[model samples]
Target: MAINTPPIAFGTDAPSSARGKQAGKARRPVPAPRPGLVTAAAAVVGVGLGATLALTITSETSSEFTGPGGVASFAGNLTGMAGSYLALVMVLLVSRIPFVEHVLGLDGLLRWHRRVAPWPISLLVAHAVLITIGYAQTAKTGTWHEVGTLLTRYPDMITAAVGLGLMCLAGVISIRAIRSRLRRETWWTVHLVMYLALAISFAHIIVLGPSFVGHPATQVVWSVAWAASAGLVLCYRVGLPVVRSIRHGLRVVEVRPEGPGVVSIVCSGRNLNRLAVSGGQFFCWRFLTRSHWWQAHPYSLSALPQPPYLRLTVKSVGDHSASLALLRPGTRVAVEGPYGTFTRHAQRHRRALLIAGGIGVTATRALLEDLPRAAQPVVLLRGTRQEDLVLREEVANLVRRRGGKLHELTGTREQQGLDEQSLPALVPDLLDRDIFVCGPEGFVADIVATARALGVPDEVIHYEAFAL
Candidate 1:
C-alpha cells in the first residue's frame, strides 16, 4: 500500500517519452473491496433468521429470556434483522461509511453485531438440538433417529444441512485469529458464501419449521417476508450499483491529514448528486485504485452536511491503515457513507459531555462543531498523551466558540487522579448533562465508568464506540 508517485509529465508527450507512459499505466494501483465488515454483516443476517425461528419454536418462557410466543423475543428477532438489513442496505447503496470503510469508527453498531451474531449461532445450535430431541422423543429408538429423519426428508434435510454448513463456516472464520490468517481477497470469497447459505436457510424455514410455516396465511406471509427482505437487499445492492455505475463515475480527488496519522479524503463523482448525506455520519471507503475497492474500509466523516467534497479521518494502525503516511495530497480514493445514528439529532440533552481519546476524537469533533453556538453547556474531556491527539485545533475552536469547557489529560498521574479531577471540577452538574465519549476500547470504558461515578445519568451518556 505504499504510494506510487507517477513520473512527472510535461505539457506534451515527448517523442522519446512514450515508454514512461506505458510504465506508469502498468504501475497504477487498483482498489479492492474490504469484506471483513461485510462478512460480519452477512453473519448478522444468518443469525437473525435463526433467532427468529428459535423464538417461534421455543416452548418455554422465563424472565431472563422469552420463548418465540413472547412479545419481547419476537420483537427482538424482528428488530435485529431489520437493523442489520437497514445498515447493510445503506452501505451497499452508498458504498462507504466511517467504521465500515476504515475498519474502525462508530463501534457500538459493531459491538451489537458481535453480540447478536452469537445468539443466532446459538439458536442454530439450539435448533439442531431441539430437532434431534423431537425426533428422539417420538421415535422408539432415540439414538440416530435425528440423522435418519434428516436424511429421509427431501428439502428439509438438504436445506438444514446447507444452513448449518454456512453457519459453521461463518462461525469458524469469525474468530479474529482465524480470520486474520487469510488474504483479504481469499477471506471475502469465503465470506460471500454466507449469501448462498442464507438463501438455503430461507427454503428450510419455509418447508420445515412448524412455528415458521404451519398455517396457510403463515406460508404466504413468510414467502412475502423473504421476498420483501431479499428484494430490499437486491434493490440497494444490485439495483443501486447498476444505476450508479451507469450514472456515476466513482473516483477520489484528494487525501489530506487533519492531525497526526489521521487523513481526510475528498471525493467527487456523479453519485455525489444523489447522495443526501448529513453531518455526523460515516462511510466505507474503498480507494478504488488501492488494490481493493472490493475490500471496502470504514471511516468517520470529519466533514458534515454532505459537502460536494467528501472527507474521512483515518488512523494508521495496521496493514490497511498504515499506508496513510504514503498517500499523496492529491491521491484519488473511492468514498461511501454517510452512515451512523450519532448525529445532531443524536443530541438530546440540555448539556452535552464529549469524551475523546486518541484518534477516536473524529465524531465527537463533528458533534462539537454541529452543536448550536449557544450556552447549552458542553464539557469536552480528551484523554491522551500530550502528543498524538487528533483534532485539537478544531476542538479548541469549538470549545471557544460555544462557550463550553474543555479538559485535557495525558493519562492518570498519581496526584491528578487522587485530587485533581478536570471534568468534574469544571462542571459539577455531570448528572444533569448528557455525555458523549469516544476513544480506544479501554479508554472509552474507563471514562464511561468515571461518568457513571460522577453521577452522569445513564440516559444522558452518549458515546460513539470506534472498534469493530
Candidate 2:
C-alpha cells in the first residue's frame, strides 16, 4: 500500500501562539497506570525474578557443598528451579485470563511470553547437561555412558527425555525463519505440544530433581506454583471460552466483500455486549466448518459490537484466511478475545492520530466509532491504490460525521512513503496526540520508529501488528 505522508499546511511554521493553542488543545488528562502496559509487564517480570531469587537463596543456604561434583549438582539444581519458575510464568502469560488480558493486553502478554520462553528452555538444557556430568563425576563413568544409564535406568528420566525432545522440537520450530515458513495451523500445533511436554516432565522433577528431593517445604512451594499455573490455564484458556461460546451460540450470518480480496464476516450471537469488547480489539475466531474448524485466526473487530452481532473483516492472505471467502452463513463460530490495547482506553491525549496501512484499517476504523468524542481524532488510511484501501468510504463518512479528519494516501510505496518532515507536517501537534498504528509488521515497525524519532513516547504510541 502507498506509504506517503502528505505535507499539509499545518506542518508549515506558524505563529508561536497558534502552535501553542493547538498543542494545548491536544493535551489530555493523565491516564491510569494500566495504560502503561510495558511498565506493568516489567513489574510482573520483576516479581517472577524475585521469586526465583528467593528460591535460590533459600535452597543454597539450606544445603551444603562439599566439592566440584557438589558444585555441579548445585548449579544444575539452580537451573532446574529457575527453569520451572519461568515455565510457570510462560503458562500464566498465555492463559487468556481476563485479569491478565485487562492489565497487560494480549499483544503485551504474548510479547512477554516470547521473551521469557527461551529462558526456561535454555535453563532446562543446561540442567540436563550439568546434571549428567555431575552424576558421571560421582559414578566415575564416561559422560555418554552416564547419559545412557540415566535415560534407561532412572525412574522418570525416559519420560523426561521424551518431554525434552518435544521442547527442543518446539523451540526449533519457533525460530522466526522456520516459524514464518509454516502455516498458522502448523505453528499452533507445535505450541500445543508444549503442554504435553510440560506434563510429561513433571514427574521427573519431583522424583529426581535435587531441589525437590529431601526438601519438603521447597517441594510444596514448587508444587503449588505449578498447580496454580495449570489451574489458570484450565480455567481461562480452556473452560471459560468453551462456556462462553456455548452460552452465546455464535454463528456466521453473512460474508460481504469490502475491497479487493477483503471480506467482512458478520457473526450473530446472544449478549455480545457481555464480552465487553473495546474498539480496536480482536478475537481469535474459529469457524466450525469441515475445513476451518481445526484452527482459530485472530481478526480485529471492524465495527462496534451491537447486541447479538460482531463483525470481522479479513483479507485473503493465507490458506486459512482465503478459505473465509467460501464460508457459508450458518457456520458455527467460537470466539476467544476482546484482546489488545490499541483502543481508546490507551489514549493519553485529547487529540488522536489513527494511522492504518492496508487491511490494518479494520482496527483504526473500529476505533473511529468509539474513541473519546473530545479527541477530534484524525485517521490516515495508507494504501497502494484506491482498491487497496479497505473500508475507506465508510471510515471517511464516520470521520466527517464525527467532525474529525480523514486523509487517504494512495500510490506506490515510493510515491507515498513518509519522510521525517512529512508526519509532523501532516499533524503539527503530533507530539501532543495519542498515536495509534496498525498494519503489516514491517510497515508498522517503520511508522513506529518514525513516530518515536518525532517525539511520541513509547506509551502514548499504541500499536498492534495485523500479522501476529
Candidate 3:
C-alpha cells in the first residue's frame, strides 16, 4: 500500500536514506546520444537505396522492353528489386543498432518499422503476380500451368515461392486486429521466421534477376550489402547481449513485495558500478530458469544501481510478469540493453513535470534521483486507488529533498480526470517546464494529447508507454 509520509512504514524494509547513499556511490556517467551520427547514417541509407534503383534501371535494355510481354516483365523486375531492397531496410530498422536506438528510442524505431512494413510486403506480392502473368503470356500458356512450369524448370523458384509464402504469413498476422488477439510471445516467435524467409529468398535474386544475372560487379555489391545487414543483426541482437550478460554475471538475491500483485526483484551482479546506464532506461531481461530462459521481457529499472545490486519492479499482468514473483534466490539473469530515450538527457528546460500512472511510478521514481535539487520538479502520481500508487513514499522523499512538489490523484478516471483544463490548473506553470510521462498506453496517450492541446511543444514532452 502507499505511504504518504517519511515516518509511515511501507513494504520496503530498507531505509530510504541508506538506499540513496548506495545509489549515489554507484552512479556513473552514461554517454550522451549523438543525433548527428544517426542523421549521417540515414543519409547513407538513402544514397544506397537510390544506387540500387539505378543499378536495376541501367541493367535493362531497349530490346527487352519491346519483346513479348516486355512491359509486364520490366515492371515485375522493377518491383522485385525495389521490394527486396526495402525489406533489407526494414530489417535494419529494428536491428537494435546502438546509435540509432539512442537517437530514436526503441518505440520510435518500432513505429517506423510498422509504417515501412506494408510497402515491401505489398510490392513483393505485386512482383510475384506480375512475373507469373508475364511468363504466361510469353510462353503462350495458361497462368496456372506457367506457375507449375516455373517451379519445375527454374533453379530457385520453389524456394522463392516458399519464402514469399512465409512473408505473406508474417504480414497477415501482423495486422493490428489479428496481432491484438495473439499473445506477445506467439507473435514474436512468428515474426522471427521472416529472417529465415529472407535468407532462403536471397539466392534467387542474384541468380535470376535481370539486374544481376550477367553482371559480376553488380552481383558482388548486392551480395555484400545483404551480408552487411545480416552481420549487423547478429552482432547487436545476438553477440553483444551474450558478451554483456556474461561479463555482469547477475543472479537474483531478493524478491520483495511492494503492493498487491506487484514485487521488486533485486539482483546482485559483478561490476554493476561499471554499468553505464541512465535512470528511466530498461533492459530485456532473461531469467535463467527452465520456464523463462527461452524468452526475454523488457522492464525498466526501478531505481539507480546500488553498487552490486540492481532492481526491477513488475506487476503481475501476464504469465511472464506473474512468474517473476515466484523466482528463487540465486536465479541467474541475462540482460540485453540499457535502451530507451526517456531519461533526463531529453529534458529541455531547467524545471520539469514528471507524471506517473499506476505501475509506471517505477520509472518516475528512478528518474527523480537524477534530477538536480535546483530543478524544483513537480510530480503527479495517478492511480486507481491509494494502494495502487506503488512507490509513493520514496517518490515523496525524493521530491522533498529536491525542493519539488508531489501530488497524488487516486480515484477512478471519471472522478479525477487529467484533461486540458485540469492539467493546467494543477500546474499553473506547465508551459515553462519539460514534461516526462510514463504509464499504460492509453494513459500516456491521453496525457500527451492533453499537454499538446494546452500548447506543450513536442520536443519538451518525453514519454514511455508500457504496451506490447
Candidate 4:
C-alpha cells in the first residue's frame, strides 16, 4: 500500500495504438440522458401518490369517525396509507431504472433515497402506535393488551410486526454514525432486509387495511402498483445485471498498482464494444471469488474500454477493496452498471474545469478522455503529497493532448486549499466553464459550496462524492 504511481501492466493486450483503433471500432455510442423523461416520470409518481391518498380519504365515512376511537382510527389509516405509499416510492428510487438513473445519477438517486427514507419509517411507526391505541380504545382494553391480542389473534399481524422490526433495524443502521462503523458488506446485507420487510408487510395492508379490505377496485390498483415496482426492481437490479455479466463474460486479466493503496484491475471480456457506458459512470463490480462473490462494490472506470479490455481503479479503503489487489487473473467478474450522470454529456459550457481530490482522480482521468479537444479543460489534481497524486503523468498527457491546462496542488489542506479566491485564481475563466468535481465527501462538499458561493449556477456545477 505505497502511494507512488507504478507502470501499468495490461498483461497480454496488444499495442496501445492498435488497441485504440480496435476499441473505437468495437465501442457503441451511449445515448445522452433525457431530462424530460425524468420529469414525466416524476409527474406520474406524484399523481399515483395523490391518487393513493385520495382513495384512502374517500373510503372513510362520517359515521366511522364518530364512533369510539374514531379519531385515532382515521389518523392511523391516513398515516398508514401515506407511509406505505412512500415506502413504495422509496423502493422505486433505488430500483436502478435506467432512464431515471441516467438523468439523476446513482449519487442523486441515493441522496433522494436517504432523504425520503425517514418519512416512511417514521410514519409507519406512528401508524403502528396509533393503530394499536385505536384498537385498544375500541376494545375497551389497555394498549399493551391490544397489541398482544393483535399479534395472537389477527391474521398476518405477526409477520407485519416482524416486517416493522426489520424496517426499523434497517433505518437504525443507515444512520451515518452507525453506518460508518460497519463494513460495506454488512451494511448492504442489512439494507436488503428492507426489501423483505416491504414484501412481508404488504399482505397485512391488503388483508387488514380499511381502505382495501372490502374494496376490490382499491385492492386491484394497490396490488398492481406494488407488483410493478417489484417487476422493475427484478428487471433492472437483478435480471439486467445477470444478462450483462453473462453477455460480457468478463474475467480478470491483471491487477496493476497505480499509487499507494491503489490498484487498477484489467478485465478481458467478450463483446465489450457493445457495452454502452459513459466516461464517468461506475459499475457495481462483483468478483466471483470465495470471499467476495456475495458482495459488489461500486468503482468508476479508471480508463474507458480498450475493446476486449476494461479497467477499474480501486483504493484499499476497506477489506473488499484491499482484496482486489490479490485478485488472481482469470477470476470472473459481474458488473451491474455503467451508471451515473457525471459525464461530458453534462457539460453546458464549451470549456470545462475538472477537479480531482486524492483518489477521486480515477474518475476525473476517465472523464477527461471523453472531453472534446476544444473543451480546453483545466484539471486540478489535489493531494497531500506529490506521491498521493495518483495517475499524474497520464492526466498531464491527456491535458496536453487536448490543449488543456493541468495543475497539481500538493501539500496539506492548510497549505494548498481551493477556497473561493484560490479556485477562481487557478481557473480564471471559471465562469465560462462547466465545473466537474470528484473527491471524498468533505472535499466535494467544500468545493461545491465554494462554487455556489462564487455564483456558479447549480446546473453547471456537477460533482460525485465517493463514500462507502
Candidate 5:
C-alpha cells in the first residue's frame, strides 16, 4: 500500500477580500507528532524485521532448541518481523513517487492505500488470533504457570497487541462515511494517535524479538533508516521552516484586488533576493503583525520562483482572512519555505498535457509561462464549475500564446461530485508528452487516472494541489 495523501478541509471562512489583502480564513497542515518520529519509526521497523529474519532462519538446533518455549519465541519473532517489513514498504514507496510537491501526483498510491487498508487489519487480527491460540495450546500441553510466565513477559506479544490495536482504530475512522461524520479537528486528533501506535509497535520489536540487540548489521540498518526519517522531519517540518522564515523576511509590497474576495499579495524578502524559486512551488507566508506567527499560511506564488518580489494569489476563504482587505502595503511578513518536490515534469517531454480545475490551476499556472510554447506542443485541459472559474481569460490567452490546445469543462457538479470523465481519445497518441494536473482532490484524481488509462506511464505525470 502507498502513503495516504488525502486532502484536508479547513474551517469555513468569512467573505473574501479583494486582491492585495488578507482573507477571513486560516489554513494549516497536520503536525507531525515528533520532529523525527515518522522516519525514526521506519528505521525501527526495517532493522527490527531485517535482523529477526537473519536469526530465525539460521538458528541451529543447539542445546537451546527444544519445546513450547522455543515455538512461541519463533512465532512472535516471525509476526513482528513481518509487520515491520510492511511498514517499510509503505514509507519507501511514498518517498519515491516523483514530483510530490504541492500534492500527491500518483493518485493510485492513495487509492491503493485505501484499498489495501483491510489487508493490514486482517494481518493484525491473524497475529492476535494465532498468538492467543498458541497460548491456549501451550497451557493445555504444559504447565499453566509456565505458559503464564511466557505470556506475561514475551516481547512480541506486547508490541503486536499495541501496534495491531492502533492499526484497527486508524482503519476504522479513515472510512469515508465515518470521516465525513467527524469534525475536522477531532478527526485529526484521533489520527495523530498512529504515531504512538507505531512507537508502541517499535517498542515491541526492539525489546522482545531476537537479533540485533548488538549485531552490527541490525545496528547499521536501524541507524540509517532512523537518521533519514528524522532528518526529513527536521528539515522539511522544522529546521528548513525556521530558516526559510527567518531568511525570507517578506514585507507586503502590494495587495491588489482581483475580485470580491480574492487578493493578490506581492511581497519581498532578503532571502528571496537570492532564493530564486520558480513558479509551481509554494511558500508559507506569515504576516508579521502581532498575530503573524500564529497566522502563517501556505499560498502558491503568483510570480515565478526566486523572484526579487514574491507574489501570492490568496482567496478570502475564512474568518481570519477578513482583515486582508485592510492589509497595508509594506507590512512585515515572514515566509517559511518552498517545500515539496513538484515542478514542471513537462520539461522532460517534447509535449505537455496540463489539467487544472478551478483554483487548482494555480498549481501549474507557472509552468506554462516557464516553458517555451512554440518549441514544445502543450495541451491544457481545465475543469471547473462555470461560475467559479477565476482566471479563465488569462489562461485562455496563455494557452493561445503558447500554441497549446485548451479544453475547458464548465458546469456545477451534482452534490455527489463532478461526473467522472476520461481524457480525450487522442490522448493515447499524446504519448511522449508529460501531464501536469491540479485542482480539487477529486478533479485531480479523475484526470490522472484518465492519463493512465490513455497509457501515460507514472514518470510522465506531475501534479500540484491546494489540498491533500
Candidate 6:
C-alpha cells in the first residue's frame, strides 16, 4: 500500500476578514486603521441637518403659519440650503485629496459620491418647484409668470436661474441613457460646468436666504466650507499635478505593442521613487501632445516602479487609449496618482488567488511579482482566445520564479464554463485563500459571486474598477 498525503484545506472555517493563524506561525497585525473618515463625513452631514432644523424651528416659532404657500416656501428654503452643503461634500470626495483617499479608498469614496450625487439635484429641483408655486400663490399669479418675475425682478435671481439651468443641463447629460450617447470628453467638459453653476448659485443663497440673515457665524461657516472645498479641488486637481509635472519632468521613453490593440508605455521621470507608489496602483496620466494633452486617462502601473521609470499597459478602450500608440518619445507627461487600495495592503491571507480577464491582467501581473514571498499566490488568466492574453510569457515567468501556479482559461464561458463549482474544482482549497479579481464588469461579477458561494469571506476578496 502506498502512503498518501492529505489534501491541504486553505484555511479553517473563520470569517474571511479574520486573521488566520497556522499551528506555529505568529499572526501579523492588520493594516493600520484610518481615523473613521466615513464616520466623520456622516457627522458633518448630521451637524448641517441639525443646524438647518434649528434655523427652521426658530423661524416657525417667530411667525404664524400662513398655510400651503408658507409650507412650500419653508420646505424650499430647507431643501435648497441642505443641497448646497451636500454638493460641497461631493466636491470634497472627488478632490483627490490624499488623506480622504487613504481613509476611504478611491473606489469607496467614488461609490459614496455617486450615491450622494442625485440627492443634491433632487433637493434643488424640489426647491425650484416648491418656491415657484409658493411665490405664484403669494403673488396671486400663474406659476410661469411668477417664475419670470423671480428671474427678472429678484436680486441675484437671474444669475441663479442661469446657474440652475446649467445644473439641470448637467443633470440631464449625466443620466445613464443620455450619457452613454456622448463621448467621455464631452461628458467631462459638461460636468466641469457644474462648478460654475455651483458658484453662481451660492451668491443667491448668501444674499437672499433668511437662514443666513443676521447669522454672521453661519455665514462665515458656509463661506469657509465652500472656500475649503474649492481650495482642495484647485490644489489637488490642478495645482499639484502642474507642480509635479514641472518638478519631475516626466517624458515618454518607449511605447511597445503587448498584443493587438494593447500597448505598453514606458516613461522616465526625475526621482520616480519619491512618488512612493506600489505596483498595482494607478495614476491619471496626461501626455502633452496637441490632440492628447487636453484629456487624462487613468492607467494602472503594469510593472513595479523603479527609480526614474514607470510602465503603463493600456488596451484600446477609447479614443484616448487608441491614440497612446502614437505617443512620441520625450512627450511631456503629467500624473495625479498612485490612487487606489488594490495593492498588497488589501491582501489578508498568506495563500492568495489572483484572477484577471483581458486587460485587467496588467494589475494582476504586477502583483504576481510584487506580492510578498510568503503569500504563495495562484494566478488565473482568462481570455477569449490565447492571443487575447496580455503579458502571458511575463506572467508565466513571474509565477515560475515565485513558485506559484498559473491557470489559463481561454474561450467563451459557453465553451469553457467557470461557474461556482468549476472554480473551486480548478483551485483546490479556494475558500481558504484571499482572492483578487480584475476584469470586465460582468466577468468580475460572476467571479465574485462564485467566491462568495465558495464561502470566501468579504475581507479577503479585493477588487477595484476604474471609472474613467
- Number of clashing pairs per prediction, in order: 42, 6, 0, 2, 31, 0
Model 6 lDDT-worst window of ten: 6-15
Residue range 293-398, candidate 2, lDDT tens digits: 8788899988766545567889898888888987877789987776887878787789899999999998888887777668887888999999999888778777
Q: How many pairs of residues in model 3 come into backbone collision?
A: 0
Off by over 4 Å in 6: 1-35, 62-64
Model 4 CA deviation exceeding 4 Å by range? 1-26
Q: What order do you get sorting by TM-score, best first?
A: 3, 4, 6, 2, 1, 5
Give the distance in Å from residue 79's predicted Cα in candidate 5 to where it truly belongs.
1.6
- Estimate, for each residue in 204-303, the C-alpha lDDT of model 1 and write its tens digit: 6556544444466766765675576667656654565455544545444555555556665555454343454434556666655555546667677664
Sort the predicted structures by lDDT, highest score first. Answer: 4, 3, 2, 6, 5, 1
Off by over 4 Å in 1: 1-113, 129-142, 145-149, 172-192, 208-216, 236-250, 269-274, 328-334, 375-387, 411-420
Q: What is the TM-score of each candidate against the true structure?
A: 0.67, 0.88, 0.94, 0.93, 0.66, 0.89
Q: Give the TM-score of candidate 5.
A: 0.66
Instruction: Give per-residue CA lDDT, model 4, range 12-88, as digits (tens).
Output: 22233324324446467788899999999999989988887888788889887888877898889899999999999
Q: Which stretches of candidate 3 lie above 4 Å from their native place?
A: 1-27
Q: Say which prediction, candidate 3 or candidate 5, comes out ahead on lDDT.
A: 3
Better of 4 and 6 by lDDT: 4
Q: Candidate 3 on 147-251: residue-level lDDT in tens?
A: 899899999989999999999988989999999999888998998888988999999999999999889998999999999999999999999999989988998
lDDT of each: 0.55, 0.78, 0.87, 0.88, 0.56, 0.77
Q: Give the TM-score of candidate 4.
A: 0.93
Question: lDDT at 369 for candidate 1?
Answer: 62
lDDT of 6 by residue, 1-468 (tens): 111131121111111232222222222222433647657866977887787667755755324347647777887888887787778878887888776676567777878877888888888888888889887876778999988898888889988888888988888898889999998889989988889999999988887777787778878888998999899999988998888888778888778777889988877777554456654677889999999888888888887654455678899987788989888877899988767777787777888899998898888877666687677778899998998898888888777767889999899888766787678888897877889888677778878888888788888888755553
* Clashes, model 2: 6
Error of 5 at 264 (Å): 2.7
Model 3 error, position 43 (Å): 1.3
Deviation from native of the Cα of residue 113 in model 4, angstroms: 1.1
Model 4 gets an lDDT of 0.88
Of 1 and 5, which scores higher on TM-score? 1
